[model samples]
Target: MLTEEEKNAGLVGRIIPINIEEQMKTAYIDYSMSVIVSRALPDVRDGLKPVHRRILYDMSAELNLSSDKPTRKSARIVGDVLGKFHPHGDSSVYDAMVRLAQEWSMRYPLVDGQGNFGSMDGDSPAAMRYTEARMKKITDEVMADIEKETIDWTLNFDDTIPEPTVLPTKIPLLLVNGASGIAVGMATNMAPHNLCEVVDACCAYIDNPEIECEELLQYVKGPDFPTGGLIYGYDGVREALLTGRGRVMMRARTEIEHTASGRECIVITEIPYMVNKAEMIKKIADLINDKKIEGISYINDESDRNGLRIIIILKQDAVASVVLNTLYKNTPLQTSFAVNNIALVKGRPMLLNLRELIRHFVEHRHDVVVRRTRFDLRKAEERLHIVQGLLIAQDNIDEIVHIIRSSQTPDAAKERMMERFGLSDLQSAAIIDMRLRALTGLERGKLDAEREELEKRIAYFREVLASRDEQMRVIREELIEMKEKYGDERRTEIIYASEEFNPEDFYADEDMVITMSHMGYIKRTPLAEYRTQHRGGVGVKGSATRDEDFIEHIYVASMHATMMFFTEKGRCYWLKVYDIPEGTRSSKGRAIQNLI
Candidate 1:
């Protein structure tokens, strides 16, 4: 705190002493909050960052780039977004718009692009000047009721034009297309889900707000990534849905196939979400060249417009399953996605679980529905008032016409009508402005029908405005309608993890012959290496030993079988048969101590 004299001195251009540490602390806090609220995080209700929302709004409201309209150049959209709404770099705005059009990036794309918009191989999109874009048909849901005073509006950067604080999106966009961003000290990584599942979960919550996360899981199941893959377990998914944070294992979808030459190969049909296909393939190649992973003869990337297909050919003697496990271990073929459900709630960053996200969307819809109903109700009442006055003039058509014609001017006619019919100013003005044809019998009946319909509409709108249940019903109906129109089956598959799983299951199960020398040397060879011979025929030497040592133990077991060796000191060791070193008939066996 500055004293009076010091404050006065500072105001008079004299420097005042201050703590640099305190100043730094305050400045950093303000900066971080700005980034958190204005830039990095997405709003919980709309599931859009500031940039994305601005781009969509500019395209639809400013450029009129609707689905049915011809697309405008991407550069024009980006320029309008920067000038009127988002005052950011052109690249950031264009990149965000491009991502919205990418099918592999978004579960359900919101924008339709005319030119190159990149691919799953991590290619950059063409420059804005070369591309064109328009809002997708589904984006209408996000912009619906926007012009009906359904949401609050704020001035843009220069305060010259007003923009909405948020869109009136009927869909639970936050969950349907999850968000990711990095703020000052935190980051968010949400997972996208199937539209049908998210809608089902949200509707279920609206029907039962107190529903637990466990029950919601029945509808959501798990994240349905756009790039189809396998979710290894439910533990992480359950944690994320209930606690807002967890990690799930993602693995590429692959199948073992055989070539015309009878050689086995692994065919990858799908990869984990957000993993770059070309980069993943390159990583595999690097690993193979470095000898970190072996057994692969070569790899072929067969990805095209049709679909993704990566073929990994194995050597003649290599085990296909073992090679696959190694690939998963050493490459991006198997990865883990961290779920961090962070978004802005009422202008503050918050970590929300599945149930909270659904609840927020419902509440936002309720607000928009109420506001929209109020607007509609007001409009209907005003129309109803005019319709009532028109009906009165139709009944007294000749008298009303005589008064209008006898009056010297339009103003005089309006005043005469008001006095005769006891109409309000608006009603009198409408009556005077009525065309001569409106007095005909056919037009009179049309007025009566419109009045009746307006009365019913006004009453319904009032009910919706006054009753929360009615508002929720409207929201539910709209949600179901969107689901029926846009929902799709889940792309990602979730597999339950078992606790008793063994790593050895990935190995080939075959018979092997184990041999041990009296000197405590041990080795294993394939059972096929030993040919069948008559009893009288001399048996082949299995292993070479020292001059004084001789064979002591021999046995046959499957590659997956466990072997136990007991020592004289009452200690026991267990090992899998496949873990043993394989040696030729004339080669010396490995030391037993090393084997154990």
Candidate 2:
């Protein structure tokens, strides 16, 4: 059924073979590049990928942050972003934006949107048009300089629209808000940080670009997640930042509240990040149904429009701490965030060590500063050139105006000014502006002073640029030293307490007796009165005969051994060797000797 051309093409493979090795190598390279560009590296300018940035940008454009207008419906913004920028579904985009706005989801949300953006209880936001949104002051300030060409732009996937290549973020978003993503074989998870703390960290980076990771820790205590849980140790944080992989434990907070009816309730104000409220409620329900918790009344989510107020009502006089400990032991009340991936280098996915992540960010900041300085210098030069030309043309205002009026173009007037004032093109343009202002004296003096200031600024910028490489080198060296000093490979997921305890109690001597039997159970008798106690039991009158009575005793020992013994009832029994079961105390009974 194949056409002649199709048949020929199919047969070509058999007739003219291709190198499979070369084809595989080419395919692998393409896959690696795709992962790096699409998943790993966040654009330096925008601090977001196409999806995230587009959502924020669309929201800003529709809501008009500068206007006193009320917030627009979130549904409308989602529709626009999905239609124009991201080709994803409206629900997905809206959900992501809603998550971003939730204070509990992010440590420092980029948008200060109003309305029910949902809660830490895992309630999904209403449809796009139902919930309203607007950009925060911080978001506007961070993105303000973007329009002035402070950053680069690249085409979107369809190559039809231009998207900002990177965010011209004044603050390092990676350190501040952090990010998490998965792509192919690699993934990244970074904890959220406080805005104030991140700002302070950025300032520290600026002041001393060569600061070490330990020194940087002075500014960033640790990740301050919006959920308000405690980070147990500093070592995990240090490891995650350095090697891009570490785990931290998080626990939910609970308070015991007593009602007028004398019933106890555990109020959970804060829950673990990323935990689903509905799921947790179901879990608690399951626990109650399974009889895992006794003396309990009800579990209520009780979350309202304002915030989370989950209340777990208990039976009257129930032990609150017991319930609390049980929740921690069995539920999502205690969880962990496993961080293992990074996004620092451009177009490459390299596993970041903590110091390396900081170093890369610091270096990127320097690059941004240099680019910004260059941009400013160019604008100053252009302004200075025009001022010089205008100053030279001040005396001949009429003639210059006549030349401007008579010339077919502005360039001809510039040429005339150049000839008449004996000025270079830049100086001529500067003088021509002064002639129009009618300032022959003050204008000339002002232009000279302005030119000198511009030169000084440019010179300063050059000096800063020149020292950047050396500064980066020094910073790298210091980070290396800190890594060498404190860099320890993580051994366990759970961070252990560092306080030392006395081992004397653990090694204390205790008396133990051994009893051997054929069946599996060890019996021990006291060592103090072995012979006397046996004689006393043997002489008992009208009691069960010694040959017919059987007995067992508790044993405590550091080691295991087997012993055979005859009961007072004349029954012979054997005990196997085994260590004492945990949580058992030794008995003070006599050692049984022989049968009757």
Candidate 3:
């Protein structure tokens, strides 16, 4: 809307003004799209970002180092991927590769490292030069048929090489080994699951696509962390599997036992996922010194190559179970994992729940299988053509030989054979160049047998390529085979302990006297603790009081009852009677306000 006067004022020579807010919004949107698409999020089909896929593809295609091959130095693979495909920092590439090699980080590690790749104690991995890595045996399921044009490819950073947009993975990589990434304005933290369970659920879905997530949960129970612990509730797990996000609570597996000195000790056998052992120990020590925790005498880390053993010694007379609960409340013994199952679907970020994720993987597998079958059928048909040509030449070898001998040159013989025998150029050329032994009846039979086998294989491949059911069957078969070979038991044990071991579950149902004294003292004593006496005789002290206070209120209740206390200001506090302090006839009770 500028006039000729503004244009003449030197505003036309790149000094034109635009709305700063609009430009900022446009730039931010562009950057966010870039991050979500090309940088942070993983593809739903392959469950890997560009860098991870590029590293694997570079190892498989460029270096030709498969699972069976000898491991190469990590630096070589990182340098190749950076210079060729991922044009990023070497440290980023190395860090990603190291995570793939870490068993503690991934439930099913994609790379097998020969040297130290770090530990659950927050140790740093060795330098890329010091560590050698190769693809795991299971990675073959992802890399299989990648060379058969089953997946799409794009130009590398320099355009000198081509990299796969996604791998043709048969295994459900997303579920087996979950993903975590932070992009612009969004992030993802998917929980890992058991391979066998996932495969079972996949088979079930293939059999019945109408099965919902709740039904699928029967086969696939919940997340299985590599460093095994215990999941407390199933509600969160169910919510996460049904919806796209939920928060599941996890706790360390600890065993408490009484020593010869009559002291209880906690032996930590396994910790929650991703909780640093050294850091956790240091934190507990700090809490003990700060007097934020009671009953912990000392902590000693007895971890070694054999296994992890963290010993937490307790002071004498400390309630072991109570102390355990306190630790769970105060320390990192219990943690919550947020499940945000977000991934890129067709270059767009999508929040997918369990069922949709499985469906996507199934669809991807179908395409890969179809493409591979087509490739196989094409090659089979070509070989079938050549074998049929040889069979035709064998049927009339003497005549062909006479024609060849009479001809002046090989080209003339080829042309004569093509014209007289109605053979195509390829068939005619193959006949002329046929081996001498191939003229014998035995060789003829061998060629015929090969042709027959190729026909059968071609028919099968065609059937698979034509039928969707056949493709799904192939997927199921591969899944079962993978389960037989590489599947492991679930590591993270999901316990309905919250439903089973509540505050009242530890005690039996019994009548009790709930008493509140005038001095604000409250206690619960079993009715059986009282003895029968004469009506006017002096009875036992109802509750021992120090401030000349008497029992002002009394109520008969069960030990499993819930008691609510109302304050003068109408503030309410409630607790189970089992949580109330037990008092004897001669003991002064605890203050109700303090107890509540």
Ranking by lDDT: 1, 3, 2
TM-score of each: 0.92, 0.69, 0.84
How many residue pairs collide in each prediction? 0, 45, 0
Best by lDDT: 1
**Model 2 spans with C-alpha error above 4 angstroms:** 1-36, 39-47, 57-85, 158-161, 198-218, 232-235, 401-414, 423-596
**Which lDDT values do the candidates have, in the order given?**
0.91, 0.61, 0.88
Residue range with the least summed lDDT across 10 consecutive positions in model 2: 499-508
lDDT (tens digit, per residue) of candidate 2 on 182-259? 766667677765545444555566567667766766655566666665455556677775566887666676789987
Q: Give the TM-score of candidate 1.
A: 0.92
**Index of the highest-TM-score prediction:** 1
User: lDDT tens string, model 1, 436-532?
Assistant: 7897789988998999999999888988877888889999999999999998888999998724236674567889999998988888888889998
Deviation (Å) of 387 in candidate 3: 1.1
- The window of 10 residues in a row where model 1 has the poorest summed lDDT is 498-507
Better of 1 and 3 by lDDT: 1
